[model samples]
Target: MFKGNFIQNLPKIYGTYTGGFLAFIILMAIAENAGVSKETIGILFVAFTVCIYAIIGYLSRTVQVDAYYVAGRQVPTVFNGMATAADWMSGASFVAMAGGIYFGGYTYMAFLIGWTGGYVLVSSLLAPYLRKFGCYTVPDFIGTRYGGNLARFCAVVVLALASFTYVTAQINATGTIASRALQIPFELGVWVGLVSILLCSMLGGMRAVTWTQVAQYIVLIIAYLIPVFWISSSGNYGIFPHLMLGDEVAKLGELEATFGLKENSKEAMAAMTFADGSPVKGLKYIVNSHAGVPDGAMAAWKFISLVICMMVGTASLPHILMRYFTTPSVKAARKSVAWSLFFIALLYTSAPMLATVSKLSLMDPSLATGIIGKSIAEVQSIDWYQAWNAQKWMHIQDFDNDGKLALNEFFMRGDIVVLATPEIAGLPYVISGLVAAGGMAAAMSTADGLILAIANALSHDIYFKIIDPKADVRKRLLVARALLVVIGAAGAFVASMKLTSILGAVAWAFDFAMSGLFFPLVLGVWWKRATRQGAIAGMIAGLGSGTIYLYMVKFAENANENIILGIDHLRFGIIGASVCFVVMVVVSLMTPEPDKATQDMIDEVRVPSGKTVLGKQH
Candidate 1:
């Protein structure tokens, strides 16, 4: 059957999340004696993993390097969509995005809106054209398009900057999931994940990752949907009777209001500012719980920077762009994106439901309780406002000994929801283990792909092209494998730090890609006048501007407006992207365009006079 499917058989994919996932099962058999939640975790440990090599082996015995890197560039449209969805919806999408909406209000929906909406641009404007080039990676496209090694080198720099920055965060997410699911040290969990990715992906390359990701997509979505379905069924079973997400959204809203805020949470969602009622700017005025955290105090640039990263991020992402190459045809490439969005919607819709419901759960004192502030007895009832602070991983602080939690006292972890869901939902330990496995799936799948992409660039783009043009395939693979280990270790080192949220780390990488490279790449592809000088200049300016802008937004908050074109990230991205485009155009007007040879190649990529070409050979 579909041995490529990991969820259908977990033992196969065990090495992907770490052999620890398999080790988790043997330990689960002894869990009762060990005082760990056993059966549920054991079922999940078994059910979610697969004997991946066995399944893949059974699926296809003989394979070529082409299949490893690009699934032989002939994956079916629907399957490619599912696999890409899995790749696109990495750990950041699975874990941090919803909690983002939770704390950020409606603003965070931009993740879905940006990523989803951006696909329209991808499929219509970029993906099919890129596929027409018949390249294995983004750098390959750049190298072949301009027929210049310098162009390829620039693309490599931009892609590496965007992808590797996120590699650590994904590894960190894997480790966190492991710590919760298996009760291991956070650092050890990361090591296990790193080893798993290095083993499965380095040896197999894209050939292994594509099949594994397809299987994982199935596993990840099922694992996610089961818990969500359970929550929905427990609340209102009728909605699951073949209804779609919109109707389900209405049902969820009703369920949330069906139970009022726990008495303690009456103070939630305070206003952002008060212009009419505030007469005193001094301490003599009375402050009510209803009064919100005033403006001019909150971190606005953080919000701006995050949105900038996301809006500009997806188009340039290496793993994401590479998936387009796997489609059986350029037409398949376009069709797969629609499918990718459809599959992605499955979880994205549920994510908001989970966040809203979790918010409700946190507010319900009965489920969340034991203590509030300094007194366990103080708010003996449910209070959404007060309980919101309980959601904080950092802890609540009360200054001046008043025993009241100020708005600033509350600090929450983005990953906390995914990790803490076991205790929060009152689910068994097994479910927690399953969730951990899910996060690991997201992390390792992405990590493996990223590490492979990095290795390919170094070995093929730099080494084979420059150092030894006559390098054999075997030697190239050897060099690629060696490079994988180096990059994997670097990723592991960063993941072990475990400081930022997976979403935040991923977002940072996206900002670099979106702002620095999207403009240059897009213009280089379609614009007739895009000279190499223009392309190089745009890349430098886009990359430099985006980088400096991010540091300003992150570090020198006081000068955010002064430093960054004084706009929101969404708006600023438009500005930064435009800056790249305009600079490229202006520079190109002053210089000669690439020779007619380059122009002819551009025309070939742009004007497809016939159906998409598709095939594979070994």
Candidate 2:
């Protein structure tokens, strides 16, 4: 028993997917009685997963050094796109966004658009230039640009805050998916996942996490796509990626005869208390849109915020920028971004369609009512509500004072979309197990990367770079390992709290990066006259504006009616980005640019090797 417990604590490290695959085995055993077919597709998915991890680990041995931090600066544009796809498609994509789309209607597309388009901005505006700088972290760029240690220190703080917040949130998302899909305790789910992240991250730094991400990318995309295939094929139209409501409608009409749909689920109503002291009014929703959700996909300002966060945040992210360093040249960096985007688009474009189709099916009367519903219930009774009741999550309330279940309340959560897919489309039990493991993979991939980044920044950027430049690389790496332990422990504690609003936390992180660094980096590269004063002022304004707004939304106990304005954390980041850009321009106009050496460096970053730029090249 002791050995088993210890081994579980330190997940086996063999294949590239050691942690995730083992967890997959554990999930399969638990799901053995989930009433799924438990055959062919499951074996195929598991085999694909193992191969993915092996390929990544085998190749990553070639990835070493500070250059590896930037992906050797040799990564082709296409691979970079694939890598970036892996980077951005974290736990959020694996679970949350699709669910949000299902629940929020077309409005959720605004978030997707923002996330996807942001990469375009990053690749075009910032990623290539930063790659040329040969910097290890975001603060490295700031330190050199400002010629001030203070600026570098500040960047570290913001980076730590933004990243840890995002990491913790991803773990929470993993727990949410596991709890719903496997009926596991949320805290146990988080701990089981976090251990995997710690092992890989603590081993090879960014090198380990990068390879792991590649493995996770395959699993995540597979888990997502397979279910869509099942659902589409199960429908009548034979239209792939297209929904046919014919079967669903017929099914629903029958269910309505008994266990009728309540006007609005009481569970959903209980979740809201409006300004007028009345419950938010709306009909109950089964798959995605529950009562009291934002009426549209997104508002205009919200849209703007999403774009800025996704685009700017990706470009400046320390770990992502770290990948470019692994590439061999500026051209490679450019090419890599293209590949990452292509791979990412595979699932991103499909997400909305999947959400829409999923909502239609889950809410179909036949499935939600009599016989089919009874079958779903029988399948669900294995571990039963007894295990779930202790978790105190997934409430089922009777609305209209009726004795029957509301069922609609489950749809409102953002992670439920993927968790319900295998079961809903009538796929095998192994798919459910695979998805649960996949969720862990997504969470671990991001969590370990973030943790390692925090550790590396402390040892490499601060202790070694600034405080003690003479420190040996090995010792520096050791220091980094120590920090990883701290970060992992902290993230686990935060995840165990069962904190909701992961999407909100992620937005705050993007805002922090955008508000504080976007303008400084943007102007530093483009404007020869961008002085230290301008960068400082712009950063302050951007970060300050965003921070105040976040406090109002997340912390303030009693808030104003402006809450109805729909300005979330993402919107706040955009406002802050604007302020920073304006302040930088105004200050630059009042002062002179960096000296000739700095200006020359800027010119150098813009020109790719073997290409002549008129009289440029410093």
Clashes of each: 25, 42
Reference-based lDDT, residue 126, model 2: 73
The C-alpha TM-scores of every prediction are 0.78, 0.78
TM-score of 1: 0.78
Q: Give the per-residue lDDT digits (tens) of candidate 2, residues 1-618.
A: 235542132223333244555565556655576643444335444344534554554445432445224333444454445445666667887777777776565455667777777667667877777767767667777777666766677667767877887888876765555455444577886775565566555555666566567667666776677677766666542466644544543444454343344455455566654333454432224432322234455555565556756777766566566566556567677777777777878888777656655665654544441222333344235342333323332333333344334444332345656775666566656766577656666666677667766776776668876888776656666676788888888887898985647777776777787778777877777777888777777777777877887777667876454353566645667667878899888987898768887777678767776432211111
In the range 97-120, model 1's lDDT, one tens digit per residue, is 656655554556657676776677
Name the 10 consecutive residues with the lowest summed lDDT in model 2. Answer: 609-618
Which residue runs of candidate 2 sit more than 4 Å off their true CA positions?
1-64, 71-79, 174-185, 237-239, 242-268, 271-305, 366-396, 401-412, 562-566, 610-618
C-alpha lDDT (0 to 100) for residue 272 of candidate 1: 17
